[model samples]
Target: IDGFGGLRSKTKVITGVSLPASIESIKARLPVWNFDGSSTGQAPGEDSEVILKPQAVFRDPFRGGSNVLVMADCYTPGGEAIPTNTRAGAAALFAQKPEEESASGPRRPSHRAPRRSST
Candidate 1:
């Protein structure tokens, strides 16, 4: 969210990168990129700059094979996580329930309890 709490997002494609690397490696190779926040309603029009910090990586289910989907949080230039950085909250939530965490992070159980049949 921006100073106004409006949700915003953008799609960025990165190419010319080597493949078959671990997600952590990809994250390490990534850099903090910036964008015009005003264009995304994330900052004032005059000095609107929002910083993106990569936090996690997932296999790009859409494109398939060695592709990735990077998860990131927004932050100010000075390093303060913006309200849009909801992963911080999720981390805290998982901290309180470690067993709830899975390889893909916290998720609801896939199993369902059996219902009793009415006679």
Candidate 2:
């Protein structure tokens, strides 16, 4: 997956204090790319075509306690340098929140068990 073996700056940890809108924005920017091989996403198509396709985002212990982890799949043009791509992409999309909302927090699952009828 993307950011599998990248640097600390690459992967990010969204604690249980992040906002839903922020999460959505980050999710929407999935499949992040580091074409210039830099932590800050910039200068596209300069060096390598490393892409990070976010597979899923869930609440887990990525940094410490229950937090949000942006899992992704790295890809390259030759399909032979997945590790490289992963590392690059990871450095690009770390802990980047949405532009508008500044509030933060985690969201609990909405699913609930069915109730049984009384006899």
Candidate 3:
């Protein structure tokens, strides 16, 4: 928010405004968050910077064809967003990278004999 716009002392005092025109404009300013939890993978001394990945894009019905709705998922250097309940035995499933297949190569199909009909 530094280079984008100068900071004002008061939140109510909006002497100026700069709005993003397109989706790319908005995307450039995304991944913005307040780092507080430990799941963000940020060290105590490191700067807080949240990361967001774009998932899908849809036309904004309310805003007509000029605007769009961007669906994205928040991710930290460690992983996706953490669940509200951080207790054991909880059924929370976080997003993770897909597993790699075996290095041996792809599996082959099995051969089977054809059956004859008893007319």
RMSD of each: 4.5, 13.1, 15.7
How do the residues 11-107 of candidate 1 rate in per-residue lDDT, one tens digit apiece? 6777887655566678877777888877766667886777898887777899887678777787778877656677767766768888764455435
C-alpha root-mean-square deviation, candidate 3: 15.7
What is each predicted model's overall lDDT from 0 to 1? 0.72, 0.49, 0.39
Show how many residue pairs clash in every candidate, following the order shown. Answer: 0, 7, 0
Ranking of candidates on TM-score, top first: 1, 2, 3
Better of 1 and 2 by TM-score: 1
Which is the leading candidate under TM-score?
1
Candidate 3, residues 6-117, lDDT tens digits: the string is: 3211112123334446455655543433333333332233534434354444456886644555554444456645232121112132123236432331244556888888
- For model 1, the stretches where C-alpha displacement exceeds 4 angstroms are 1-9, 89-110, 115-119
lDDT of 2 by residue, 1-119 (tens): 22334343355443445445455565674446433334333213454566556656765565544356775555565544454444445444443643544232233345678998897
Best lDDT goes to which candidate?
Answer: 1
In model 3, which runs have C-alpha deviations exceeding 4 angstroms?
1-47, 78-119
Instruction: Tell me how candidate 2 scores on lDDT.
Output: 0.49
